[model samples]
Target: MRPMMSPPLLSPSPCSLLRFLRLCHAPRRRNPTAAPPTPYTFRRRPLLLLPVAMSSSASITAPNSVVADPSALARKVAAIRAAGPSKLQVIADFDGTLTRYWYDGARGQSSHGLLRQGNEEYDAKREALYEHYHPIEICPDIPLPEKAKLMEEWWEKTHGLLIEGGLTYEAIKKSVSDAAIAFRDGVVELFEYLEERDIPVLVFSAGLADIIEEVFRQKLHRSFKNIKVVSNRMVFNEEGRLVAFKGKTIHVLNKNEHALDMAAPVHDSLGDPNGSIDDYSLVKKRTNVLLLGDHIGDLGMSDGLNYENRIAVGFLNANIEKSLKDYSKAFDIVYLNDAPMRGVVELVSELCP
Candidate 1:
């Protein structure tokens, strides 16, 4: 069970809060040719030596939670608060980070897992694949290069099975509707907050893009303009049946390389008059990022972006005792088990509100 919230932390000073509000309300400059400005750049700085207060509601008493360095965490919080939402970009993993790993003592289905349900034959084959590949995917003992090769092979075999099983767009919708797939607590609110503020959110996943879209459409009931999904998109035939996957496959480890193209729209919307596709320049202008994910590999989600401040919040949903150390190294702040996204929501609120 989740623990109760502690008392409220010391609020930001009125002056600092007002400054943040001004930044949030600052209008975007769309005229690129209006001024001859200096070239953009970003530098990583150590956390500030300022006094930091943990949000009363966000303070976790759970034994599984891990914050490797409280000073660094405070610095991230300060950096985010200082930059405000207008200058922020969020890149997140979909499967376990956004969705609950376990619900009501039963394992919840990921986008890919949802398609494997309700069919005995498919379930049997899926289980077999999991038994063969899942260990390699998660085994810390295996080297990443080897694991990457195995993961690609696993995805190839699974995609083949999905095609043989006659997976369709309609079938995906039905599966998501019938399966016990649910977003973690506070995810809906989090989406709403980002959407209302017009902050760009990219859901970068190795899961099926079609399934992810259906889940959002069916569950969230809105086509959020601010939220973009980049993953393995299924190519359908003339008759709307799954035929092949479009583009190069994006497995867990290679997400950073794939991110630039997937995040093009975000860069484009920043009003680059040259119509240039330089993701680096666009991202550098944004300068502050909030990254969220579930696995250690996910820490590379923002690999190419030049960001002034980045706060990686990781959800350690499985193997808590063993993985906490690694997760601590990968994420600035880590939440354990099935803990709701309250901490994330609170952090975002502090920046955007």
Candidate 2:
């Protein structure tokens, strides 16, 4: 059974999480030109720091930058084109957003999923955690406060299970390679565009670091130049043994603090009144964003951006019939069982003036 909530926890209820998530993913800050002149800076993000990285540059591997159709994405594209990758940033959720939610036309393994399947001991424990928490995770009817409590328990238990699995850094690498997670459609093109333009892409996920990198390495033909994965990373010692995870537990709901911690210095350095904006302001005068996510909780993926205009596209990978309305409401555009950024491809093409 899931444990009840205790004090000192973060994450909102399912509805609240959805509501705020819907609000947050839309890129809250607009009006980029109003800010005073400031130097644009870019920094290599440290694991502990958050939301501190932003940049502008694009280097395309393939010539597939612009998508077909000019009507649908025209306005957004114009905004992005005008904003010119400078005032824009990309923040993505890994498991379902960037990677395929399922595989072989079925649900694929996640970092946690693979961890559970790593050995026999994890099998029963995984089932228990799933039975106890997965239902609550998807139940929008539940209140945020109550859900937060459940999530805390779920994460704690899951972490314990992973630690108990007796995994080493080498094991993580092996698991990740064996899992062979595929990137969602258009994800490759998207990654390429961001890198070519030097626009920063922050991957904030509940997945592990090793797996995230593995997925990227497997998906992209070229190396990742402008991307940073802010998901949980394991600590390995000299002997390459896994010691512990780095930083506070980042459950699905507790991203704001993580966002702040990462973005604080950047936000402060840029002289933003609300604290800092890292080296490059994620949402600057040309502040526009193209956000992609999967879960209701994912809407907060870009909780730090002060966007002038943000276009969000969600991948409704499962239970679409039941949650379609809520998904549509939560995301500006919702793609049902579609690959990552497929809608984005269509959306980018349609961004007219």
Candidate 3:
């Protein structure tokens, strides 16, 4: 943990910080239909500073990229640190955020991409869907609402394809076993730290919940009580076959805490107060947020909450030069070249120490 500076003079929370960061970042015409962006909400409170060592502060600086305003980033960090972990929650996008964008020499598979439904024709059809919609997903030209609708269409059609292909529970398990997906380096360390601290981590995703659970069971070897996943859930029949998805399709645009009620946590093995995603009473009280994601829209993952403070970290995995400016504007911190999660682990330490 790093040493904290003495509590700075307390001041009224700056509500316009979000607008200032966006406006000064890069000049762009605002979309009339798009929702305005949000920033870390600084709360006015009496705070106690913890005097700790400063050795690890250097580790928080990534060699890749960061938001242009270091002072703004510092202010958010200080506010969050002052509030401490008791008031904090971690909300992250699973694919490309928890998982790596690149592994070995090729692209890594997302929870959705790792599925194999056992029918060759169906597999081809699903790949076709990805080919068409993924481009639209990353395109900056489309309007936000229109893009959200397209994402819903993509997910709906893909789910229909899975059911049509006779997807079985056994098949999902096998697909996970055979998939090339892997977590980003240092992700386990971050999760372990959060688990030990009992800091709630909501793995919010636009992918399949079943596959994410399998990843935990097979890859991580255990489930953390402090963590819960909310994603598209598959309904399996008595014979253990996937019949349909349970609720409204969670697409990239709409993948936020708002979708928590539409689905259930896949790993409820904890079987206690913290096991279920449906019971978020504890989480609802933690208003300071630590948000992680790969897309510019991932910052919206905390949208459902009345957060008092939030530090958004974005992973710029691809199309670097093209999206870097916008990403820097939207996120408090941006890591490029698919950086490891070590920086985040260090960040959490500072906030919680």
Candidate 4:
């Protein structure tokens, strides 16, 4: 103050001064005996103290049929959905991925296995090959390189036996029709869905290509326009009897090496020297892949693709208990005990819809 003031009624200490200042600025408390104030006058609660309504019962729905990790699957599904169906491609193994592992409670036949039946000579050779190679193929402890060499030997011997058995085109047709080979549950629907969306399906198999085509033709009515069967094709003689296989053997291990070449378009009309037909260019643009397989080797199906995202679905139909961990490690999603493709179809629907 400009002038010295008279002594105060009481000389307050620093603590008392602080109290006086706080009392002057502080909000007034309601009288203990008085009724409570109206809603407008009531003090607001701190956000932290507010009661939040919590759900008593919560549920979580997974997208695919069986997934090793639900959160990872959700993130993958989200990425695929964001990309849409136009950018999506499906690479599936023909034998156990698209066809049922067992049909009518009996072990189903693969394209190669179809020939093993209905012929004594072929059956005997197949049994021998199985005795020698099947153990190696299924042995989890063995390294892949060693297993691959054994598989190549098995395929070469089996091919020679098939040729010696005089397997004709007519015989193949008959074998496919007679064998208990059937498409897996939801396979037809899966094809239909992919076809409707113009999504390409590459059936990459180590089995017989001719038989694979025949099966699709006879069973699914016809091979879809968007589907390409890439496998070991059988070469036939002028008389329509099996002469030899057309190209290098495609065993489980070497399937990925042929992916790029198989994806290349073979011009139907060499007459057009201008080479203007770019029919398959659209396929190259689809950089997201959905891979389905039963064996661990099937993971190589997408190896050569310039894919932005890949969702590997493993169908564990046999040795499930021992192989589940391995399948989960190798594949993003694993379906146990021959689970149908319904969940896969559902996931496709969400992505494409």
lDDT of each: 0.67, 0.54, 0.73, 0.66
Instruction: Name every residue pair that clashes in candidate 4.
Output: none
Task: Spell out the clash pairs found in candidate 3.
Answer: none
Ranking by TM-score: 3, 1, 4, 2
List candidate 3 segments past 4 Å from native.
1-63, 263-279
- Runs in model 2 with CA error above 4 Å? 1-78, 116-119, 219-221, 260-286, 349-353
Better of 1 and 3 by TM-score: 3
Tell me each candidate's TM-score.
0.75, 0.68, 0.80, 0.75
Q: What is the C-alpha local distance difference test score of candidate 1?
A: 0.67
Per-residue lDDT of candidate 1, residues 1-353 (tens digit): 12123233345566655553343233222211112212111132232111111223343222134556755555556666766777887888988889877755577788887784346797789779988887787777788888889999888888888887777677787888887777776787887788778677878888887788888877766555566677887878988888888777777776763444543332233333444222333544666778999888887777766566778988877665466667778787776655566567767887667
Candidate 2 Cα RMSD (Å): 16.2
For residue 335, give model 3's deviation from the true position in Å. 0.5
Off by more than 4 A, model 1: 1-64, 116-120, 260-284
At residue 44, candidate 4 shows an lDDT of: 36
Error of 1 at 257 (Å): 6.0
Model 1 TM-score on a 0 to 1 scale: 0.75
Candidate 2 structure quality by residue, lDDT tens digits, 1-353: 12222233233235433432232233212112111212222243211111111223132111011112223333444445554556667667777677766566456777677653357777678678888898888787888778877887887777677677666666666666677366665677776656666666677777676656655554463455455566666666788656677777666765532443332122222233543223443333335667777777776665655556666666666665466567656666555443335445444433321
Leading candidate by TM-score: 3
What digit string (tens of lDDT, one per residue) describes model 4 on residues 1-353? 02122222233345534432232232222212212211111143211111111113243111112344644555556667667888888888888888877676567778888774347977887878877887788778899998898899999999888888887888888888887787765688888898788788878898888788778767766445566677887879998888888778888776763444443221111122433223555665677788999899998877766667677888777675567668877887666555556656755775676
lDDT score at residue 48, model 1, on the 0-100 scale: 16
